[model samples]
Target: MQTTDPQGSVPSDVPEPPPHADEPRKLEARLTDADRVYRAVVSSGAAATLLLITLIGVFLLIGAWPALKEAGFSFLTEKVWTPDGQPPRFGVAAMMFGTFVSAVVAMAITVPVAVCTSLFINEYAPRAVRRSLTSLVDLMAAIPSLIFAIWGLFFLVPALAPIEDWVVAQFGGWLPLAEASATGGSLFNAGLIVACMTIPITTSIIREVLAQAPRHECEGALALGGTRWGMITSVVLPFGKGGIIGGSMLGLGRALGETLAATLILSIAFEIKPRILENGGITVASGIAIEFRDAKEMGLSALMAAGLALFIVTFAINFLAAMVVSRSRSGAST
Candidate 1:
């Protein structure tokens, strides 16, 4: 029976009917076994990812041991990469330089174009055309890198030769990387190919992220009498900064490891060149691709060492990119 107040009426604050009989049991189930099991499963997946990365590092280190032992510390500092000589002297100084320059060039060209393309699809395109533009960018990412390599080697190089020559003739002396060969297969040319390969993927990634920007923020900006460009500058750009950074870095990784494009186009010089367009620089991936076919024993080990260095560099870069993405997702900026 229900309790009553001073009179015969039921108490003003009636009990809440003792919650449903099954509610407490359901609540307990969620807080105990179910929650713990879900947490453990997610944690294990993350741990597995880290373990795989560690195993890869260990394997590369072991594979590279022979060259390291033979060359000592000089393997890193020395510029020579002649692995077939008697007593075999080798180093990756040149490949490292080429890797840096080519990847930098690729990122510089790819990032701006990708950002603009993504913004166009996400912010400015007609609604009917948005899907089509996005699909076009997605299609480009699926094109084989081999196709890009072949096109760059035969058609693209020859077509761009005249323009490259003019740049070399006019600014080669004053600008650091303005030098291009008559054939147009310089470090810059290879970088351009890599940029083309990267842009589609980068644009796709950025457009996807920008699509997630809060709708209210966008509408509010326009309602405040902001122009389209003003809305982008004040609202969309800030909102998608993390997506932009993450996509660009992923594109950088592609540029770093591009093999056939660089190998087929570069003159494969053994030293750093200030002029980006001059004949040949040997990037790590291209070096491995070119020499792996003929490498034997010690030569093989030396190539493994170069490959390992590339792995380390790419790993560090990706790790930093992940951190930046994290900051962006958490709404932090600095």
Candidate 2:
């Protein structure tokens, strides 16, 4: 047996161990001051945003308090809105109904087409075609709201006349919607115009969200011999459902606040009724637009109350969207 030295077993060139096991922790400790500054900046930004929203809500409430106190809760339920005489009174029921109906109709039209268009752009269209279409959609989106209003007034409204006429001729006896005349502007026209207005926004948001779908999921579906449609319906759509709902709600919110085009297109009456074809219906925004010039002092406050109502509606929608997004992130993490 050969004698082996312990010193020979260890390499002479071996380096000493690192100073401490928690060296990384020490380095991080040194960064505490910088981390504190960063956290302060983030907290300040969040506080600023909260402050701004709070100020807005407070201002709206202050402006609306007189009308709200006088009318009580019946302001929401009452149909009459005359503010000119003694003991001035106003109500938002008709405006509320019109706003809801038009928004609903717009969403009904926009959601399907937008989702389909986004799906096609994301999964079906060739890359070159998708690029071109996406550019066109973006261009359409960038067009000013006023321009859309003008174009709808001149072009789309007229173009829709024949289609409206045909629908009335074919379905008039069966449905109340079909009773609407082709020439005059109506709820159907305003709803359709709003739908058109929202199409680009909805399509763009849905496309971006769907494009962010997990690549591996899609690949796995394809590998499993799933058809393109089947893969989209099952994998892509389920993944994007939350985003889609959020986008739809945002679009609906836009429709609710739309003023110029809706005012120009929809026949505005103060009374509430169900006939979409009826000569008069006015959304809250449009009502404000139409009546603001002639409104007296209390009437002005009444309009502000409606504006406050719209603001609350939109804020609620955004809050709901945030909740949906949070839930989606949690589900994805799990």
Candidate 3:
């Protein structure tokens, strides 16, 4: 008989070994050529922005070099500005002081109103009302600076004169701004005008940024039984701090470069006074705008130097804003 196995199973060829437990892991590839090109393009665009800023600085410096070399460092500290006589003495102290004081006054006036308006829009107003009000603010922003100057000169100045007189009567003895407005135009007037000019921009930007704050963070604050003010102060502000700073800086930049409005409203005298309502002070931009028509040769160069100084200040403010934004982003990521 054939001796066949009871279980007539076919024999297996072999058993495969299991995958190794300690094999080196492979990583996904980083990027393709197209992706690299795209990244390079983006980087180049960013570099181009910096390059443009550098070029502007270089151009400004080149244009102002004659005055800069002639005046040396004393140009910054000197208070008198002649610009017409022989050798044409030009000092930036009065202009610089005027610029800073007007800007400060504008910021002081703008910050409170802008912040409050933004808060009301974000937290208090109905959706319909908020939309309408926001549109109005945007419209205000579209109004030309020259128009604002005209309004300030023709309308606001007259309207504010009585108020100015009241202020002078109230504090004239203690402060110089109250020393009587010889022509009804003062640094205070310019500052108030600038405040009006900056309000729409600051309020709109701040409202938009505050609106972008993390909803969940605000909700969490509410859930913790926090009042609306408490939630805003603790959560919303901290979250939107960077944007607030950016908006303020943007307003400051506007204030620094404002020419027509301040020039129209300010007295443009060379006298530098500590009083906000003083009549004699003038800003760099206003100085340039007012005198550029008459300026020639050395006078033109000196005015350009003033312009360069304003440019540097505005650039520095914007740079600080960028750095703040970057740091805020980094902190958020962590």
Candidate 4:
């Protein structure tokens, strides 16, 4: 039986009832004036960014319409580029091929190096040197593209010629792609330069992602008798996979639009050049850069069309990359 104190209806042994048992708690935070102002500012910034992107797309479309109408679908398929001709015929086929090929080659070289560099910085570097190394890598990205172009043109192109020749000699018979008639200035050289340009940015992204891998999981793996390398493979690599992909794609986009280095390193040719080691390839960005000064009205329109294609492709790649990153462990998607 419930006991009652002398001065109270119920004894102290009875638990007190909770306040507002039937009412729902306010889950949302109450916005103050400052919070409202902040939200409004952020919303305006986002809206402005979207408006700018829309304006750019509209501009490109308007500028490209004349060329697209003149060439029709053949604008995509034809291999020749002679927009200033009497009838004005041109196509992005070969230039687009070069763009993709060079970008792919750059990624092929950049990804492994970036991944290794990031892993080293995050997991293997000495604490004393880590900060310095990270700063150095980041500083590399701030260097101008024109500097890289000039360096590649004057130094890198000549230095790579011997190596390119050796490769061609070793594999020319069995690997058709390894053969080259001229190795001084080629798509391969452009790709190498672009890869160098892309490495720092890609590595920075990957390092940040890898650094964010759950420390507890890494410790757990080690506690379970896994080696450091094993722990890294099991914990870090898996955690940063999405970031790696995202970083690589971002690098690819950079490589695709790289104008100066490619223009300086590549010997332009209109035909499709599957042999990257040969001294003949041209990318869309380089094409536009080279033709812009001398281009007539039709040529300018054709160049704009090419730029539109590249813009669309780059946008798609980065969009997909953002989606991938958002789905991964490292993304703050919310």
Candidate 5:
């Protein structure tokens, strides 16, 4: 029952606490404080990542200033990297060419193989075999680049020699890329090694993405008198296309930055050449790895500039990949 309190005010069984309330207010205040702390931590993490990249760019630009001042654009255009010469003529044209070309070759090999393998694993493989094969792929990803480099040097190079020779015999007369020099460390060989390295990563990514492809859509297609192949073509492939593209681009990014394998697999060269089979190729990372130890003054600066170039290339590739992925996103209206 209601009753009059102090003067004429009515009071009920449940009454509001005074301003001095303890536990509830304290808990609410604590929750708010914790939320603010969490936000600050997350914001700091993002800000730190951005700051680190900016700092790296600053350092590279500052270090490369002397070389950029003297050489101007020749550092980019010329095809020589002689630090000991009279004029100390150095250029990254050959390295940049090799980097892009070999990465392209790797992508060419990796994309199709990865896509096919991933499809089989995700769509067709029996459950028992699927787990085993996926585990094997994960094992491959865990394998060190040094191990791949050694295997490429001792085994793959020799094994591919016969194939290279045959291709040269058949197509060397017209197709420059198919032309093979006897040197085992040709760009083609390096590219193959790079492909091998990229495959596991690409396949894993594709498989994961493809696994998420709408199962009901696939079933719907199959229900409409579609064969397995027809269903995949009409439903699965379309759904996974963006994922496949994104995975391929990620693999390409890895290939572009690959240092140890590329360095060990390719015979570093200073001049640019059209033949992909040539023994002379030097990727940017490989260039830095091989040159950094011996570099002094301008040479160091040149290496810095080269590093900057690779950074720009990687950033651009990632940016473009993001655009491609966004454009190709499933369920999005064009």
Candidate 6:
């Protein structure tokens, strides 16, 4: 039975609930003066960066307007870039083709080597040697583009000429791509140089992503009697798939924009050449660099138009890469 208190209310053993049981706890951070200042500074910096990018795009558009107005849709379709001719019959089709082909070739070479190097460095190397290897890759990334161009022109081209000739001779009959002359200044050699330039940055990004793969998942795979290669295949590779794509796209963008190396290594041709092994091809960036020095009024505008095209392509590539990364497991911040 229940007992009554002095006021005749029934009493039980249960204690009264605390004052506001249903009210949610406030989780908001208390901002200090320093915190507020830091937030404001960071916000301004981000805004500034966006604004700067917008300004650059606006400038490119303004500068390219005259050429685009004159050339109309033909700017993209026509291959001949005789800007010096009356009415300026210029277009980016051939240069764009060369850019894509060389970039594709570079990616084909870069991706495998980068993945293997990253995996070996992250999963197989001794901890003592890992840092050194990583630093070496970073150093390679820091090397100037001009130096790579000079090296390709003087040494790499000569070294690759014999190999190029042999490959062409072996496969030329069966493969149209291999039917062209295997000269020193071909897109093939330029692609090789671009591949070397791309490898370091790609390896660095992939290595970091692979290193971030869930440790427990990897161990679980190994515990399930999986071999090292099997564990990596099942765990690390899946986790880093987005990063690999992102790195490859980034490398492709770099290859497309690489001016000095392409300019130095390629003998520029205005016509579309599907055969990358040929001695002459021109990328958009290389064309711009080569033509800029002697360009007059309309020619300069035409070059700006070309620059606009390249800028759009690179911007799209990077934006796509960012989207892929943001949707990937490795991109999660916490």
Query: lDDT of each structure?
Result: 0.85, 0.81, 0.83, 0.89, 0.85, 0.87
Clash counts for the predictions, in order: 1, 0, 0, 0, 0, 0
Q: Which residue pairs clash within candidate 4? A: none
Cand. 2 TM to true fold: 0.85
lDDT of 1 by residue, 1-334 (tens): 4577677775767633445674454332226788889999999999999999899888889989999899888887766777877969888888988888888888998989998888888877899999888888999999999998899888888888888888889998788778554546578889888888998998889888777777788799999999978888788788888989999999999999999889988987777768778887889999999889998888998999999999999999999999988877623542
lDDT of 5 by residue, 237-327 (tens): 7888889889998899999999877889888777677788867788899999999998878889988888988998998999999999898
Worst 10 residues of 2 by lDDT: 22-31
Best by TM-score: 4
User: Which regions of candidate 6 are displaced past 4 Å?
Assistant: 1-32, 331-334
Write down the TM-score of every candidate: 0.85, 0.85, 0.84, 0.88, 0.88, 0.88
Worst 10 residues of 6 by lDDT: 9-18
At residue 171, candidate 2 shows an lDDT of 79
Residue 96 C-alpha lDDT in model 2? 86
Q: Candidate 6 lDDT, tens digit per residue, 84-201?
A: 7786899999888888888888899999999999999998999999999999998998998888889989998888888888888988888988877657788888888998899989
For candidate 1, give the lDDT. 0.85
lDDT of 3 by residue, 236-309 (tens): 77877777777888888898888887788887688677667656679999898888898878888888898899
User: Candidate 4 residues 96-207, lDDT tens each?
Assistant: 9999888988999999999999988888899999999999999998899898889888998888778889999999878879888768778888899999999999999989
Worst 10-residue lDDT window for candidate 5 reads 21-30
Candidate 2 lDDT, tens digit per residue, 206-318? Answer: 88888888888888898999999988977888888887887787788788898877788876677776667545688899999988999988888888899899899888888
Query: In terms of lDDT, which candidate is strongest?
Result: 4
Model 1 residue 162 lDDT score: 83
lDDT of 2 at 214: 85
Clashing pairs in 5: none
- The local distance difference test score of model 2 is 0.81
Candidate 6 is scored at a TM of 0.88
